[model samples]
Target: MRLNLPSVVLFALAVSLCSSPSLFGAEASADEKQADWIQLFNGKDLSGWTPKIRGHEYGENYADTFRVRDGLLVVSYDGYQPSDLMSMDKKGKKGFDKFGHLFYEDTFSHYLLRVEYRFVGEQVENGPGWAIRNNGLMLHGQDPSLMTLNQKFPVSIEVQLLGGNGKDERSTLNLCTPGTNVVLKGNLFEPHCTSSTSKTFHGDQWVTVEVEVRGSEVVRHKVGGDVVLEYSKPQLDPRDPEAKPLIVDGKILLDHGTISIQSESAPTEFRKIELLPLDDK
Candidate 1:
């Protein structure tokens, strides 16, 4: 049957609407475009992340080391117990020395990760001396299965989040190389811990830390809107047994890897963990 020009146009329009709804229907709002920021934590469950702790299996949590409460991700020490003091401190006791890191399930090359965290409650009994309100975000982290059974940390560059004591000047968004190194000021800096220029954030206040990463090229640490630290060329340390094998051509540039949050035997909470893709690579 022969159809009128208007009828033929109407049919084509219907097909196009079904094929591309956004173009034919109402345009996507600005809020929808910004909504591309992916929420890594679901706020109600740990669906896309896994926990790995020293002396435990790769997937095993080793006593609920990480959990979600009140829409916040909490790294707790109530799961670990000392064998020597099992019965002596039955009334009120907490013992945890294991260093655990909660890792994202997937790996990415270049992206922006933003997270908000705060130190809360008290440190677990007999926790490490340096772990008082201590935690970090391990970017370009090795896979949990690759880490040694007793390895305390993975081969990654850390955007260390340090909460300040009530009276001292401490900086957050610091760069820490557990098994990696970076270039700064046109030199190969080899410090294990590099402090950021961020101001001291004291008490149990929420602090937002944003990290910008571009494969093996550059990484920047930001607090709020200000970039506190910037570095380039993440390479593995050849001297470290756990790190040497990861080196590439005597220089291991971290182009793509996992991301993780630390469980340093301190009580900490994370409200938002999100990422934005910068490129296809």
Candidate 2:
């Protein structure tokens, strides 16, 4: 004969067994959950970091344009005018290119980096038109000694970020190989490679950019949770004029280096700058 227990009793017994501490250890506390996150920015100060501006000394105070306001790192220019600086063009007029790069002190070889940025203020009229819609995050930055005394910018791999007009939509996460070449689809480029297409980003909105870098092979760029660009084996192409000098003595490839944020021509803001170290899984 079979013994049939009441359905309600059986259900109660099963529930009690599942909820018992013996079956599953105590639940994780709030502190345990927070351990997963690391604060890159303290939100109150700029400690554990340094800044580099164009005109000023390498480690001195940042240029007037780059500042912290309302708890956000703002690169603003309201009272400033382009006509005050020396010109880079043949016309010989002042422009924003005078201040080119603002680099961070810490460097990383392979890691996952995340940043949130937004553009502000109107575009400077009749300014350096080429750089009107500009700003970049440079990775694998080389030492300043490699550049000429008059050189204004660092030679690094730029993950070019652009806020485009509707008609000319360039991808949000594109690679602008500065002083280098990249291999894609099994072919070498002439040290100058543009993205196949651009992903359009809405203007004046905070966009999230992420990059997963691993040495000279397999670098990935993601925007808003989607993988937008990927490249492998970035090195100098001997054929290109700019790259020729870099690879002439066989010492141009970069495997690991520091990261930097560019202050090209437009006013921009970055809120979150963080990195997560990756381990070989």
Best of the candidates, TM-score: 1
Task: Score residue 61 of candidate 2 by CA lDDT.
Answer: 40
Residue 124 lDDT, candidate 2, scale 0-100: 54
lDDT tens digits by residue: candidate 2, 1-281: 99899999999999888788888756764334544434555555555544555555555444465667777776665645555344555676555555556566666677777888887766654446656556787888765435543355566778887776547756666778767677776776544447635467756888888888887777788876677778877675555554466554686666777677766667888888777765534
Residue ranges of candidate 1 with Cα displaced over 4 Å: 1-32, 84-96, 248-251
- The root-mean-square deviation over C-alpha atoms between each candidate and the true structure, in angstroms, is 7.5, 6.0
Give the total clashing residue pairs for model 2. Answer: 3
Please state the error at residue 41 of candidate 1 in Å: 0.3
Candidate 1 C-alpha RMSD relative to the actual structure: 7.5
Highest-lDDT candidate: 1
**What's the lDDT for candidate 2?**
0.67
| Full-model lDDT for every candidate | 0.85, 0.67
Count of steric clashes across candidates, in order: 0, 3
Off by over 4 Å in 2: 1-40, 79-82, 85-94, 144-149, 191-193, 196-198, 236-249
> What are the models' TM-scores?
0.83, 0.76
Per-residue error (Å), model 1, residue 106: 0.8
